[model samples]
Target: MRWMSTVPASDCGRAGTKSSEARLQVDAWVAKRGGERAMAVRARARLVELVAYARTRSPYYRHLYRGLPSKVTELAALPVTDKSQLMAAFDDWVTDPAITLERARAFAEDPALIGRPFGGHYSLSTTSGTTGKRGIFLHDARQWAVTSAMATRMLTGWLTVRDTARIAACGGRTALVVPDDAHVGGAVMAARLRGRSRVAALSVHRPLEELVEALNDLRPAVLAPSASLGVLLAGQAEAGRLRIAPALVCLGAEGLPMAEHARIGRALAGAKVRATYNANECPFLSYSCPAGWLHVNADWAIVEPVDERYRPVPPGEASHTVLLTNLANRIQPILRYDLGDAVTVRPDPCPCGTPGPALRVQGRAADRLTIPGADGTPVTMATRPVAIVLDTVPGLDLFQIVQTGPATLRLRLAPAPGIDPDDLWDTVRARLSGLLVRRHLGHVRLERASERPQISTGGKIRPFIPATTSAKP
Candidate 1:
């Protein structure tokens, strides 16, 4: 609270190297005001500053904002930046021209490079190409500190101070379920966690069974894993196949559906289940507000929802693309960088009364599905809804359900290590089959694959992908 009281109102729109620092200052100022209106004003001012920075520091922004108005009254006045745009100028767009795609790619390809910093100080990570193109991102020291602070805020915001104190009292070990390879985000997280002796790091790409075994052996009170995988573990608890009573469960990387939330909650024997919404492209974005609404960390990163033309859409209106500006990572200079996820802004103030903007993501734009309706008509299915069902099942950690044909579907799964592959297939097939008419499922076949899974081009994974057309519905 004291931190919020220290925010400087003018810092809300200040650009350049001190953006994050200034954003926090603005946060303190908003906190001092003691309510929602103050936060909204701060958010508006912060957006203005972010656009100002983009117009000046980012090449992509210069082209996007060639003749924009002097004042950014609406977020739409700013451009809707996308992945292709930022990547085109990947080399020039970064604050540091020395960090190139070739250099980042080469660094990411080497597994041995895991846990090592890139360019002497910056942490490097690569995106899993579920969206078709892999991305390389960097986080400077300040960004890391900001991210850590925000993460702590997220956790504490979910649990009461007393609960947090009690959880810490247990000396609960944190097991981060993330990619272990040299891909930028996972590697950075792995490095930092490994450096901390108390926390344990586990690879999400590994078999779910093995991950479960490790969890059982370690008995960590903190369970932080990708949302889908967390749901899988919850399912295992439902089936009596696995059990762990962690004090907290933080889900990320996928949407946590209400159904899956119930399952995970039940599986955890009443433990709190919270969601973290972030990606490799931008380190600190939003955390779930106390009211369970995802609130953007407007002080650190600026997120804009834009239409096809890159113009901002009305709040609560659907966005085809998400443009992000990372205030913390000056080394990469991510000004209005496009993140490939479809998101919607919450239309109203949160019950929790946080001043930051609230969001309800429709899941990654890539995760939706297209299939024939029950009447034989083509139907576009959204994966966010279906994935909720998949996550409730136990043992299946990573999955890709590709519809090879209208009636023929092939499911690729990377089960928990040491799990009975046959059992996983049965559970997944049964759950998936039930989602549709029994006849449409001509034959449900499951296979094991080795590729690491990630959210698709739209910044989320497609639980159901139509083979004929590559686009997600």
Candidate 2:
């Protein structure tokens, strides 16, 4: 299919802006000769450009690339960077000397600066801090433009011009149901977009009744929520409580099981149910295909599936972890960055005819824990809030909360270096107990686990695990 081929060359180039240039490059990526050969050419070209830029501008990359050949060709030759390593050197990781880790942290911490551009030039967002370290990601005007353009193209893959017009004509309100925290990527994007159009940034942390009321009142045409909460909201829609008929329902941040997807689709009564695979590191990684596969935007971003030893995994097999390199963002060079998401690449091309690799992800499905409510029935608690509490506690690096019984929870924590485990445990227990008490789970017993938390088969450390028939203590 022809993609953006009719667009004039003048339209592609936006007054010589870097972002416009990047967008134009991405536009060309779609028009490139289809298949692996074209992808390799595009990927290599972008990689060389990014590496040269990073080595010259960023101190961290300079040091990391020291002793390496001036012109690097092999991706496997580059060193891998994880959250802990990059964050430890955050001050030197960015290309802009004006952008410091301290300043970025300060900006991210302020609720008032949620959608505001950092230093009037760059947009900022933070990771959920689920993996012990919260990542602060920044995008310059150019990078932001490219990312936005990529997103628009991905949406057009599913949505037609007519569909876009209808949403715009129908008051076009998009409800973003996520944590209210300003530091998150979704919140930051929502806040910036709010300046351009109508967007309701609803918090999942709020009471369900309040969310239902707010959504019903807003009657949004587009409903975007994390996967788990989408399931709950689907129930609300199924019960006729959430009266809004959104033209599109998008789920992100978490996994969407086939059963849950079908349930949501049925509940929405013909609304398009789509899933987007995204992270704060690279917002426009992939979008769901009509065939239900995720086609990676390899031209703008590269994701390498690696085994436990960091060797490249064969297609059709799950990777121990994925390495992501964001070609769109040059301000922060995320070259060969380790993103701990288990993914399986399709060995064959998608039936939907999209170019590039298709992926199946098994990542970040934090299970909900239930406790008896005042009505003597089980009250299901969203795992995100519970996980956030422990994640926010300084010195606690890794943790897992296992519900051993109806009123018992086992907490396993891995404290950061130099942190007192006992002290950290005390803080975690106090904060978690307070949250539980507020949610009518005060009677739940919280115990410390003697063993480290076990990683899931998919190679992820799930923060919350509900007891099941096959659960082990």
Q: lDDT tens string, model 2, 1-473?
A: 11232234344324138655555646645544455556566677667777988899999999999989999888888999988788888889988898888788778767777778797678888764435356778877645665666676677777877768767865998898865555677777777767556887887667666788998888888899877778778877877887777778888877766767778878876677888887778887888876778888776678999998889999999988899888767778888888988899999888988776798887556356666666676666767666555545666668888888878899988887899988988998998888777666778899999887777765566667787522210
Top TM-score prediction, candidate number: 2
TM-score of each: 0.70, 0.86
> Model 2 clash pairs?
none
Model 2: residues with Cα > 4 Å off, grouped in runs: 1-39, 128-130, 165-169, 389-395, 414-460, 469-473
> Whole-model lDDT, candidate 2?
0.74
Clash totals in order:
26, 0
Against the correct fold, how does model 2 do in TM-score? 0.86
Instruction: Locate the minimum summed-lDDT window of 10 residues in model 2.
Output: 1-10
Q: Candidates' lDDT values, in order?
A: 0.62, 0.74
For each of the candidates, the C-alpha root-mean-square deviation to the true structure, in angstroms, is 10.4, 4.3
